[model samples]
Target: MNIVDFSKEEFQNQQIEASHLEEILKDFRRDGYVIFKDIFSKDYINELNADFIDKYGHLFSEEYKKNVFRVGHRRIQVSVELKKSFNTPYLYANPFILPVLEGIFNTEFIISDLTCVTSLPGAKYMPLHRDGAIFKGVALAPLLPAYAVGLLIPLIPFTKLNGPTRYWPGSHRSPLHSGAFEGNPNFIEPEIETGSCILMDYRIVHCGNPNQSDEKRPLLYCNYSLPWYFDSSNFRFDPHLIVDDNNYSDIPEEYKSLFQRRNMKLQ
Candidate 1:
């Protein structure tokens, strides 16, 4: 299936029925992950693609000139464009996204950071790791019971051949003991279509499978957590600054809400 074929209008018009939501939540709780097919519209995808290209196109050139990893490679601690993209209101209040989160974590949640990944052909496999590793340095005295959930939206179709994500079904329940499963030979890769989204527990042991196909696998990962936890994007970008004053009047309600700053009191 061509993952990039649908426009934004089509996505916005797509209705997610009650049954689908029930099945999704059930699979998520049972399997640690669930795929919602064709949740994004082509227009949104195009806008996102153009936005990313205009902002980070330089990375591609730099990679070419330096003979470095360009497509389908792991790049961490990247620039702020990815965060800004995720902060866009359309994503925050996505019809299919929020409800699922509310179902699992109840109503209280805020997106903490965004990770944009583009896996080009021949991209190397990622080491299995839990998203909760970020909390390792916090002192136990003030240790809060914060949890993070990863919302992975694929801009391009995801398949075993295109480096789909591999996950351990029940590993989230015992994250510390999940260990590295990618090299264990028992890992299973889930086939996901473009515009599909997957919600995962931060403690789940997982990794990006290597891409063997010729197409690029681009995905946008939005990490959500309670407001008290440290945000991965807080130090790098301010969500407020990215909004254009002139465009405020035209901004969608959802977008406006996502960009609103929250106050976090240190315990």
Candidate 2:
């Protein structure tokens, strides 16, 4: 329920208060997730949203159905193109999030993927699930340190009418699967606006709410994980993060490590 407000003067000046940063780390560590409210500019978010719709919105059209994978009724997942409006340090290697990520991983993490999950009007609520499976054949999977985290940036406001994600706090540390937490009242579906995002441990128990509004709810989902961890389950059909030549060249030298796992065109 605690949301980090990044619009404060200190945070705006590229300096996050130590206490706020500590709270972010502690909240994520204890709750397995945290919400960042209005951390980005509305104009910037609108640009990305417009570009995303211009490039990939056709996937939702009845006439153009290729490369679309349905995750639930009326909800589909597709790949995101990292070019033009989306090829920036703020979107990928954000300074504001890096510190918290470092605190969680305690190591250099890679930007594993960039995908979009769009829930169309009348979409049904998705079944409770974890984004990835725990380490198979390992008895201590639940005991391991955080390996991967998911960051969800919504193109539009995440309102109660348009599906927002329902998260069961602290369920990531349990050895049991997400189904064990089903129907629990101790869950939260926070309605956040544009310029905000949610970061969650990939092992956490959660699901998307039903979309009751007429608009489409699109979430720009990016996955960040430790250098050695590869998510082989999610992108089985579509390609993972793809960085075009232009975008790749634009990436800062220091942040290139984050895109080491990205698929790129020949130079």
Candidate 3:
């Protein structure tokens, strides 16, 4: 599949067009990934970056934070409450991103995991893998209508040296969905800026490339999935770490519908 590249001006000015969205969904379903370029606001990204540093500067020195940092891998554990520390309403209310989620679940979808990812220098290469549990026994091609999607928002400009995500264009349908499938020739290292978001199928074969740069690459990932689906497959969200708690008071009114707690009882 040919890559769809949108300029900053086009994405910011006329983003979310009906035709463009249809094509995006078409490509996403067929290729397991779609890239939107420079659609997010730089000011927003900068502000959030500053906010994270300000509220959590102490974390940069903590043992837990240091323990998680190694060659080719790094993460800020979910134990640190994020919804209360940084800006989340913007992500939830994003016009360019929300529609992509809508394309998958229409009116009834929710976030499975929202967490921070950082790849420090010497970070090891992560092999291709799924974000959630793969369905039982696949046959010819992989299944369609994946249960979830990963939305990656870079906090800084991404480059091969800084460690960008590597995705196999059409590997979502490969029969060996659960195995370590080789994607040497078909992989793409998309140079996404801080403003562009990478939307991908949860079933897509992808991984983080080793970060060879001196700077730590930071990104915010929101894994969106069906309201009924449980996301214990990856990082589990402890209730104590959740600041919003489904009250919908902190998040913008428009985006509250996108969040649902896993074990919460219905009214």
Model 3 ranges off by over 4 Å: 1-15, 60-62, 65-89, 237-241, 245-247, 262-267
Full-model lDDT, candidate 1: 0.59
Q: lDDT by residue for model 2 over 15-67, one digit each (tens)? A: 67778788899989888999987778889999998998998888898875554
Q: Predict model 3's lDDT versus the native.
A: 0.67
Question: How many pairs collide in each candidate, listed in order?
Answer: 11, 0, 6
| Model 1, TM vs. native | 0.70
Error of 2 at 189 (Å): 0.5
Candidate 3's displacement at residue 83, Å, is 4.2
The sequence of per-residue lDDT tens digits that candidate 3 reaches over residues 115-161 is 66766566778766776655546573376576778878888889978
Better of 1 and 2 by lDDT: 2
Q: Model 2, 81: alpha-carbon shift in Å?
A: 1.1
Highest-scoring model, lDDT:
2
State every prediction's TM-score relative to the real structure: 0.70, 0.94, 0.82
Q: Which has the higher TM-score value, candidate number 2 or candidate number 3?
A: 2
Instruction: Please give the ranking of all candidate structures by TM-score, highest first, separated by commas.
Output: 2, 3, 1
The per-residue C-alpha lDDT of model 2 at residue 46 equals 94
Candidate 1 local lDDT, 51-149, one digit each (tens): 766775565544453543322254322223324444455676676677777777765666565546677666787777766645443444113332677
Rank the models by lDDT, top first: 2, 3, 1
